[model samples]
Target: MTIASENTTVFDAVTIDRAVRLGTATLHEAAGRIGALPSQIARITPGQSFAGPAVTVSGPPADNLWLHRGLLASSLGDVMVVTVGGHHEAGYWGEVMAVAARSRGVAGVVIDGCVRDSDALANVGVPVFARGLCIRGTDKDPDGVGGVNEPLTLGDVVVYPGDLVVGDADGVVDLPAARVDEILDAADARIAKEARIMAALRRGETTVDLLDLPKETR
Candidate 1:
């Protein structure tokens, strides 16, 4: 069910806008507080964030050729979600790829591996979320076991092509594209509820009182 009909639009402008506004945290809450990728995968550019349909890529350890293919296969507003078979030290992405991605209108990237060229990546205007940075380069093995636009499991979250991928400073979360409307509705309600709670806190209500937790016993 991850792959949908070719006629189905990968993502809509309105949905991307709303999802980016709500952010990964709110959408995760709306998704029953699940589908969060590993916390180690975080934003490389401090203020940058993105929300777009995923173009999942699975690459072999220490190899990045599939990522290039994934980038080529993607259209505007696609987020490349890649996993590199537990190889965390290779610099699988860098400034050059960031420049190319920005030029092609890729919304962002989330990889379960490392990236390098911090200075240029921070300036290239593409939001990248990865495990960490590394100086070691990667290979482009033609015989490597990898595929573009395939399902990938990063940590406990399963990412499939066309799923909505949202990433912010907190982390990344995958929301099912088919449930975008439902998730948005629930996120709206949660925001309203949290707003009321914030108002209550400003009025001097304690967390225990607001949440109705049992009183502490000596």
Candidate 2:
């Protein structure tokens, strides 16, 4: 029977932590040039990075009814992913929400729209990434509803519930939990290849020579 539940499934803590420790950029490379969120989604507060499974949500331009539900529905280590139907002018998330999320052990929040309370958010103790900040508040529209654990897109990547989400100063990225091991393996190879290139440079080889750039291009 079909049923509704607030609980969102997630990957193991160790797997997610390892991906977070690997950083978003490496995962992008590992995932074969995919999984990086748009550059427009940026860190509002500095010095914190996070990795966790997504709990997707969305709503209209300035209604945050879904976000309120997301907080109630989220579990420890679940990162809230909000897409506001291309609305980038509402402060749908802020200090109050950040505080609530932090208390729930929510890893972080990524919003396609705007947010506010930058200073207050800085002290809220959870990382937040958004398109920009706005002081305008959202409406508690009774007509508004948002889905959780659904697929989400951020211009640069698509994310699903339980997908590994890694974010930092570089940006955010998503990887299907089932593909984590394979992607990490590729990342390891890429790192090794870069290491070899660095070693060659230490031997006084020019980058152009090591990379074999076209003579005319150099």
Candidate 3:
């Protein structure tokens, strides 16, 4: 496979599943293997241990009509990632949307804005990561654009419609579709090396010895 570059764009689910199944630690580790870009919402429900394709939505600051539409259009085993033009105040997701997403077989949601209904979301057990929580509601006056299977900007990172999104308590990561195989191999090597280092530690090895650090010149 060709090396994935900054401009390469694709969202192959098969490659993503291979990476996830190789035991890449967590979503955060898999992200690190690709590139550290997606941010965590500080506090949110833990994500399910499943990998799937991403469906992206982008629109005006306070409108979420497109989000609702996107939810209805999404297929099974998809994660709805929304970019609300960086407007961090109004709540873009809540109990109703979560329920709808779950019914559509969506794996979870990652939004660059606020969300509401923490208790309900916890009870439903559908993962949601956002900038924060707020009671401020959004407007139904539909505005802005919605793109299915399109490239979008999320925070400082660029995400394509089908890019692999691996998110957990640590945060969310966007892996380029093309380089999934290479990154998975790298993560496997990393885990094996860490295991050996851990075994040495259990045998009473010091940090300096385990890490091969030079002795102090004192």
Candidate 4:
């Protein structure tokens, strides 16, 4: 499903933050627990964990001119999500961009390519997720692409604009727009149930007894 830019709405930062605080596991389990198809590309910069509305970008591999332009055009509180056609050869994000983004009130960046300047990024406190770290630099020309606010494939899943995205130590999960409320409710219920189970465990209840499993299963 290709989402058109005109149809895409970048959600408010408050909304995304609220969703993140709700509970990571609940958001995942409610969304059927589908993980991002790509494995471990995003590195959360120390002291830079954040959730916000997505500003999606798409461009050619190994080029980031468009990304630079996107940064300039992105609004405050937007999380710049760059899809570099899964290019992992060169670093598309670096300390310079992170600094600029922070000044612009950008939430963070999620790139399908690579990033560099890890120490600087950590020091500057900008969260970044990428395929990996690479010292290889990207060309500013010949590889520039377009930014369509539409739903673009990141890793293995289609991320629609305005859909909730929560990323923590566990991983990133894309929440379906229609199911956000339902998932939040489910998460609340799950938390309540877990609380009771935790109390029982504190009282020396075994897993079998807490879960009501049979002796044969235990």
Reference-based TM-score of each model: 0.94, 0.91, 0.81, 0.84
CA error at residue 101 for candidate 2, angstroms? 0.3
Candidate 1 overall lDDT versus native: 0.88
Clashing pairs in 2: none
Q: How high is the CA lDDT of each candidate model?
A: 0.88, 0.83, 0.68, 0.71
lDDT leader: 1
Q: Rank the candidates by lDDT, best first.
A: 1, 2, 4, 3
Give the per-residue lDDT of model 2 (tens digit) for 1-218.
11126545666777777777777898898898888889999999888888887888877778998888778778899888889878888899988889999999999898988999999988888999999889998998867666666676889677887777888999999888778889877877878898999999999999998899876844
Candidate 1, 1-218: lDDT as tens digits: 12222222467788889988998899999989878999999999779999988888888899999889878877789899999999999999999899989988999999999999988999999999999999999999888888777678999988878889999988999988788899989999999999999999999998899888888877
| Tens-place lDDT digits, model 4, residues 103-174 | 888776888788899888887766787777899988777435556466778767887765666665555566
Candidate 2 stretches greater than 4 Å from native: 1-8
Which ten contiguous residues of candidate 2 have the minimum total lDDT? Answer: 1-10
| Alpha-carbon RMSD to native, per candidate | 2.5, 2.5, 5.5, 3.1
Total clashes for model 4:
5
Candidate 3, position 32, lDDT: 68
RMSD in Å for candidate 3, one decimal?
5.5
State how far residue 114 of model 4 sits from its true place (Å).
Answer: 1.4
